[model samples]
Target: MVQTVKLMKNRLAMYGLVWVLAMVAMACSSDDGDDNAGSREVKFEVTGNFTGQLNAVLITASGGGTSESINALPWSKTITYESNVPTTQISIAGAGGDPGETITVKVIVGGKEKSSTPGTATNSGTIAVAAPSYAF
Candidate 1:
């Protein structure tokens, strides 16, 4: 199935990103959990700079079911952000099982802002994507 192959590719890309984020989180001693349903609190390797350059990578899930699509999210959509918390959330809008399976939250940043500086990693509510002013 062509669609299946495409889904696999997308999953791989997202996994790679999450792996990088996990390593960074370990270095900072931050919490990680599946915000949608798992309670994961991953530490992001981004320093505190509210210049509006940081963006949250929001991932909504998709699967088979009756009331599919939670949060009224479009089929597999991604949202951009401008400075927010180091953590983002991902999950199927209304799949009724759990949040997005497999490393859901990850960074869309090309590089780590902390790699260049020691004692890096910022903690602010700016990385949140569930705000009213958030872009979908």
Candidate 2:
């Protein structure tokens, strides 16, 4: 009778171990369909008929930081990030160009234009433009 009881206890322990391992395997498995589901492509652009170079250009980068560029005309920057990003911004200030020349700042997301703003150069031959912040 003692031998039979020992065999039953061993079987019970083995069953418990198997159950625990199955639970662990299920917990470690991933059920989500796509790992890149929230990924997005973002682009910032400056364009128009402004003659000279663009200055004081500020753009929001993929890592949620501002980047500056000087003497960049017809400028564009593209980055990829997750959709959880809160906001993105772009701006150009006091660009020296022909008076009355036009300039536009734009934010594009996922191949679509999210925001655009246009400005005209002042008589002093400078233009400043800023696009509205884009929210994911």
Candidate 3:
């Protein structure tokens, strides 16, 4: 009986020692130096120019070229544009959202429906936002 009691006490001590060692290791191995302390990452930017009244414009994207889906885009608007003068001061909010994604821009001039020819987006590609974040 005493032997069994001693065995149990030894096991208890070993367990306590292991627990203490584990705690110490965890504390010492922690990120003692702020790994990401001062490092900064770059956002995305989406820039483009479209002529015509720009009846409507849609910005799209895809990630890893998988789904081929239009990741982030805008809706259609009912605005009339002039003939000679092209649209100016055009900027999208969430085009530069996620990186490594495919982007597509669609614009309709005169007629309705998605069948309208889509205008080129100046190859903004994966837009990188560098300022205040805008939620869509």
Top TM-score hit: 2
Q: What order do you get sorting by TM-score, best first?
A: 2, 3, 1
Better structure of 1 and 2 per TM-score: 2
Off by over 4 Å in 3: 1-74, 82-96, 112-136
Off by over 4 Å in 1: 28-136
TM-score of every candidate: 0.21, 0.60, 0.23
In model 2, what are the clashing residue pairs, if there are any?
Answer: none
- Summed over model 2, clashes come to 0
Highest lDDT: give the candidate number: 2
For each of the candidates, the C-alpha root-mean-square deviation to the true structure, in angstroms, is 16.8, 26.7, 27.0
lDDT of 2 by residue, 1-136 (tens): 6776445444533443444334333333221234432336668788888875454333234433443544456878887755454444555655346899988878777666666889998997766675665444
Q: Could you give candidate 1's per-residue lDDT for residues 1-136 as a string of tens digits?
A: 6776445445534553454344334433233222332222222222232232222323222211111112221122233322433333332111112222211222322222111221212243112221111111
Give the Å shift of residue 3 in candidate 1. Answer: 1.2
Candidate 3 per-residue lDDT over residues 18-50, each given as its tens digit: 443333333322112334322222122222332
Q: Point out the worst 10-residue segment of candidate 3 by lDDT.
A: 59-68
